[model samples]
Structure formats: structure tokens, C-alpha cells
Target: MAGETRIWTPIDYEADGKQSDCLRLPHSTDLSAYGWVPIPLVCIKNGTGPTALLIAGNHGDEYEGQIALSNLARETRHHKVSGRLVILPALNFPAVAAGRRVSPLDEGNLNRSFPGDAAGSPTQMIAHYVCAVLIPMADIVVDLHSGGRSLDYVASALVRPGRTAEEHEKLLRLMRLFGAPISFISDGTGGGGLTTLAAAAQEQGALALTTELGGGATLSKAGLALAEAGLKRLLKDQEILRDVAVEPASPTRFMTVRGHSAFVYAPSRGIFEPAADIGAEVLGGQIAGRIHFPDLPTREPETLFFETSGLVACRRAPSLTERGDCLFKVMADIDVGPDQVSHA
Candidate 1:
């Protein structure tokens, strides 16, 4: 039963054609002696070339990637593709179906489950297959994400640091090719390996590009277009797709999250009123917003200020705030090349 412990897809992996099927994960319950969880996936393959693994819906609330990916899965034909394209539009199927960040079945956060256990929970099994099986078959991987219901972000491409210098250069190239307005270099510093699908992919020698399109538990039109266009561009750039007119890569602003100072957190629990909008340039000591105490109508809202000056890359969407909640995350510009502007 060792082989039964791993996920099994219903399509022939080496077949040269397009197939859409569910990855079956064995599950047993009182209702059925043997059951299976169906995870949606699609594989498009032609002749020999680089394989690209495109994924989305790591968090169920983020919709841009799923929308764009579903569209691609339905419309993309094997005739135009040169290599394999394995796409999982909703990686965390249960979470996406529930429209929540974590899986309702096992309460699992998929992004945090890397190098997972085969005999683990539902979400962990999915992660285990992705880490140990699917990724090894790819030359590149792209995981699309957003701020979900909690935050909003400037449409950006993010790749964590720690890859070899050569791998880092490849990631940067892929990020630029995706053509998002801003490209972020995350060291994966404070995430504590929780936000780690891309990092895991990177470690497997796959040039991974992750995106934070737009969020609020709804899809963004512009963000979806960007995602669709970017995926096409990536396939073309990798020479995996033919007869595709690749769009020009937009000039990207290179930036990085320096450290803790790049974030501004709520001082006390209250309703937040933002002073600076997303994408706004702010000063080091600028007023970012205030947290209002609604219970005490007579009391003043505690004003919060930006600790570091830079472009407002991300901000909490919900007005309701709690102490230690991150109100904003700033990204400082870095020198990527001579042609790029000083982001700081």
C-alpha cells in the first residue's frame, strides 16, 4: 500500500495531448470503506521542451489566478504547445470550494505544507505530491497568490531569496518576463517557512515566480488580465508555446522588504482609517493612518505613522484592526541594473 499512499492522477503523464482530470487522494470514512478526494488538474503536452507548472488558489479567497488559469485550461490546445504544461488552478481544492483561506476539511493551510507527509491529512497529501512528484517534472513553476480577504496589494511579482546567484538571476528574469509593475525580492525572512510553495519549488531547481495580484475575496479585472498575459508570456519565453504572440514585458520596479522596519503594525485594537493609499509614496515618519475606538465615541483614534519611507506595497483591507496587526508593508527599491530607477 506504499504506492497507494501517494496521489494518483487519472491521465497518462507521458501522453502527447491535452487531458483534464482530478488527482485522486485516497480517503476512507464511515460512509465508505474507500473513498477519494478529487483535486482538479490539467496537463497539456506536445513534443519535447521545458515543462512549466502553473498553480493558483493556494489561498481560496484569491480569485484572479484561478479565473485566469481556468480560462487557460479550457482554451489552451496542445497544438500550440511544444512542451508539458501542468496546471492546478485550485491547489487547495477544499479551501477554494469553501471560499476560505484554509481548507474547511482539515483546516490545513496549503502554502505552509511543503515537503509534506504522504500519509498526512488531505492538504498535506496534496502538498507532498506537489513537492515530491509534480515539481520534479518541471523546469519552471509559478504560484499565483493575493492578499486574500485580509489585505490588498499593488499587483506585483514576488520571488523569495536563498536560491543560488545563478538561480536568483533566472528567477529575476522570469519575474521580469511576467511583466508585473513591481517585482519584490523576499528573503522569506519572517514568514517562518509558512509562505513556502515557491521556496520549495526554488529549492528543487525550478525557477519559481509568485504573484500577489489583488485581494479582498473577489477577483480584479486588471489583475486577471495581468495574470493571463503573464502566463502566456512565460510559456512563450520558455519556448514551450508556439503560435503565441508574446506581449512586451513591462518595465518592472525592483524592490525588497528590508526587515521589520518595512512594516507598520496597529498600536491598539480599533477601526482603522488609512491616510495613505496603496501605491502611495510616503516619508519615513509620515502618518499612515489611525485606529479609532468606536466604543468610546469621545476618545480619539490612535494615529499610526509609517516607520520606513517607500512605496506602500500592501495594506490591510479590513478596517477593523487588532493590536500587532500589520497595517502596511513597505518595499525599498534596490539596484538591479543601470536601467532601473532607484526604488528607495
Candidate 2:
């Protein structure tokens, strides 16, 4: 460790580190209206192991995942890592400030605009920075996420396809290192968005995994704890840290959703009453929820049901409902087979 240079990217932040006051890296530019956001690309420069990136807050509303990655950056400052660790805890600052799903001005979901252009919109510029700057430099990328808005996500991982079976297995090992309770595998390329930055890392042949830690808007202690444990596991798995323990689960149960899936929505506007819970299995034509028409005869409540069979991955919020509103999403199981399909 004598020859190693532990470089911390200095930025214009508050004394308590709550606010971003200035750019840490001297070479900073205002890409858009978001002001001088710091691109904290620090490195140990030992030149001995793999370089890994941990990113979060692609969607501003997912606070738990953002907090987990932020805490990791703060706690591991003095740790002797085997390789480089780049942490971008909050990528969408404006949106995070508003506690909204997408940027308020452009009304763009940063996750959807991937490999963004420099001269495009503000979100595009950020996307462009991510793709052009941090991504290419990473050897392994872990994009952290949580349910944005009014939803909660069970812990899961989404991996890209096209890796060799051996490489796929290796990717799974790294995903497990995060130690999420449930590990879901889908092709990373399927979703065309800025959030698919993990897939971009995979495209570069860097072992990548995108994880969902908890729900949206708020932080859960259990979710944060799981992510903290998982990150340490990942650090040990990548040889960036020592004395870490791996939570062993032989034959890890991973659910796969391949190809196009049906998203069930409420056909008629009414108060929504859901019958099934998240992670529930359903048969085709299963009655999922009811849209009770307010101030009606109440004899014919509009029934919402699944068209195909799978799991209830996501559901709409609350008693409020509108015509053509999404009630729940059903992902029909497909064969991933030898070919890997890109999933979001």
C-alpha cells in the first residue's frame, strides 16, 4: 500500500456533506440547468484488481437505494480496496429534490433516455455523461434502484444477456454478493432507458448487475441493511475488501421474465380495490381487482383481471382509479434459452 495513492475527488459540498456547494473535481462543466454536479471519479490506482462502480438514484423517488449507496461511499472511505470504486449515489438531483419520478422541467424520465446526446435535452446530457464518462471506465457496474413514486420493490437483480454460460454464472455470483433476498434475472437490454446503464456496462463486457433494494420515496431500515450487507459481499467477491462473509444459498431461486408481457389496467374509472398482493401468482383471467363505480347502482362493478398468467410484479396505487389506468403488470414466463433477451 506504500505506492498507492488514495485520491478523493474534492467537491463544493456543505461541511456536513448534505448539499453540493461546488464541484469536487476541478475540471467540471454545467451540462444543463442542474448546475455544477460533481462527477466523483476516485481511484486507488493500485493497478492490481477490477474497477467497480455503484450507482443509484436514477429515479429521484427511490430514496432507500440512493441512501444505501451514499452510506457505502461515506463508510468505506478508509478501507483498503483491491480495485477502484466509483460511487454516483444521486444521478438525478433535481428530480430527487422534487421527490418526483422524472425531471420536472423536461418531463423526461432519465431512465428512458440512455446513451444520451451531449447537445440534446438536459436529461440527455446527463445520460450522455454517464455513457461517455463513467461507464467506459468501469470493470464491474452495479446500478442500484428502488420503486419510484408509490410502489415498493422486493429485492431483485436484472442482468444482461449475451455473456457465455460461464460468464452468466459469474454474473450471478456477483449479484448474490449483494445478498438481496430475491434475485430476479432478465436481459438488461430489453428496457430502452437511461436506467439501463447497467446494460451499457455489460455491453463493455464488465460484469454488471442492477439491483432493486426497496420501495419508492422513503427509506426502510431492512432495505438499507440488506443493501449494506450486499455491498460488502460484493466488495469481497470482487476482492476489493477482505474479511467479508458470503450468505450462502445453494441453487439461488431466480425468476425470469422473457419477451413481451401484458400490463393489466383498469378498463373503467372507479375506486380500485385490489384482491391480490405483490409477488402473487395468477392464472389467466384471474380476477385481480375491482373498479367500484362511485354513486352507481353498485350492481355491476367493473372487474379487472389478468389476461395472461405470471407474477404480479407491479401494481397501481390507492383507491383512486381512472379509465385505462394500469392496475397490475403480469409478465408471462418465457424461455431465456441460449439467447439472452434485453430486459429493463
Candidate 3:
């Protein structure tokens, strides 16, 4: 952990102290120089054991996760932590303000640009900074997220596959601490990459998990409360905080996806009418939605059916469909090893 002590740029480590200002990344430009900007990172570091980093705002449209993280920072500012707590309330500052998924400058999705490049696109630089600086310093990491922009998702903890029974149990315990109703283990649903910071942390052998709230291009008090309470539970479970009373997790059924499930799409251009809701279980050959032609009012619309059985984890909001556009994604139930899958 000697080399791991320093993350990203140059910032001296101060145990359990507040810094009134954020440290600015060198050569970071404002909107005047480039079409985008990087704001100084406002970090609150506390405690002195293994570090745990809490991050949010990777996708601008997922506002609830960011807000939840921000709210936790405010409530726990004076918290006496046992381990180092690094809070990056908002990583994609510009995107959060604009309410979009990708960086507005190059329209790049920041989550996909891991271990970023200084001379690359704006999003790339952000990935580089987070991967190089913040991630290396932590023993465990919890990334906050939700469906971006036009998608709606059920709240769940997406964990990697192929863990020993102990690892799996530990992860489940963490999920219960997250206080979410569902926990979907990511059995290679998201491919390995340099784009996502979560992947970067996992690659370093950290106990990493991504907590997704229920929101897309919107925010809600319920979602925010879940996020805050989940973090508190995690911190307490990690032994970083001493006085939190965490509820024992109820018996949970962990489902694994058999393979890359399909996101049902529009067969033709027209308005889409979905018949199912998020988190609803569907069967193979089930009619989930229909595609209607705007001009051909007299002609009957085409109904779309599911090819496999699983949960409807994501669905388009407008119920309006476009040709070849995905309207729903089915997460089929299957068994997979925790180490066998990695969502980089």
C-alpha cells in the first residue's frame, strides 16, 4: 500500500480533517478554453484505517445518486470515522448541471473512459484523473449510479461474479447494508473496460460494488433517502463509523443471468406502447409491448414479445418507440461465478 498512498495528482493526506477548498487538477481548462471544464474536487477526508471511497455523478442524468451522496456528506461532516473516508459527491459536474448522460463537450460517456488520458477528450481526462488519483488510495469502493437519460431501472447492487462463498456472502451483506429491495449480481452484463471507474477499482482487487438508485433524468426524496441510508450502513459495516445501528438483511434470493440478455426494440418506426412495468417478471414468448404507426391509424400495430424469461430491469419512459430502438432489457435468471464475470 506504499505506492497506493498517493492517488491521481498532488494532494497531501490529512487524517480526519476538513479542507475548505478542493484541489484543482493542473492544466484543467474552463469552458472559455475548451467547450468543457473540470471543477476542483471537493473532498472530505476522515478517519485512519483502510480507505473507502464514495462516488456519485458519473452520469449526469442519474441525479438521485449524486444527490444522495451529497446529502450524506452534509450530514456526516463531523463524523468520527475509523478509516479514511473519501467522498467525491459529483464527478461529472457539468453533466449533472446539464442533466445529460455524457460530457457535453464531446458528447462522450464518462463511465466508458477509464484510466483517462490527459491530452485526450474531456471525458477521457476525467476518467484518467479518477482512475489514477482517487481509486488507487482506497481499500473498498462504492460507486453510486442509476439509469441514465431515457431509461428507468430497479434499485439493485450490481456485483461481480466468481466470488468464493465467503466473498458472495460478504457482498450480500453489503447489499443489505445498501438497503435496496433487490440485488442483481452482474454476471458479465457490463463488459470489462477502461471507461468505468467501478471496473478500475475492481481490477485493483478492492471490494467494489455499484449501487444504482431508481431514477433517470430526474430525482426523488425516496431514492435519495435510500442512497444516504445505504452509505451509512456501508460505512458502519466497514467499521469506519462506530455508532450506526444497521438492520439485519432479510433472506434474499440472488439471481444470475444466463447470458447477454436482449433489450427489446422497435420493429418499425412509430410510437411505442409498453404493457409491462419495471421489476416485473416476464416469461418467454410474452407480449411486452407494441409498435404503432403514426400515419397508418387504420392498420393494426405490431406486438413485440420476449424471447427469454427474466426481470424487466430497464424500460423506456415515453412508451413511444422508434425503429430498432431498444424499449426493454430482460435480465434472465441464471447461475454464474463472481470471478467469471467482470463489468469493466
Which one wins on lDDT? 1
As for model 2, its CA RMSD to the true structure in angstroms is 6.5
* Candidate number that wins on TM-score, 2 or 3: 3
Those runs of model 3 whose alpha carbons end farther than 4 Å from true positions after fitting are 1-11, 23-31, 34-40, 162-169, 187-194, 334-344
Q: State which candidate has the highest TM-score.
A: 1
Model 3 TM-score, all chains together = 0.85
Tell me the TM-score of each prediction against the true structure.
0.93, 0.80, 0.85
- Measured with C-alpha atoms, the lDDT of residue 253 in candidate 1 is 92
Model 1: residue 98 alpha-carbon error in angstroms:
0.8
Candidate 3: tens digits of C-alpha lDDT, residues 241-284: 76866565444345544454456777888888898898899998
| Residue-by-residue lDDT tens digits, candidate 2, 187-226 | 6443453356765677667787777666746686776777
Q: How far does residue 120 in candidate 1 sit from its true spot (Å)?
A: 1.4
Q: What are the lDDT figures for the candidates, one per model?
A: 0.85, 0.64, 0.67
Can you write out model 1's per-residue Cα lDDT over 1-344, one digit (the tens) per residue? 02234688878878999999988877778997788878889999998889999999888999999998999999998988998999999988889989999998789888878767788998888888888888899999999998899889899998766345666677778888999999987756656353478867877888888899998787788889999999999898888876788779899998987778888899899999999888999989999998899899999878888888889998999999889988898888887642332211
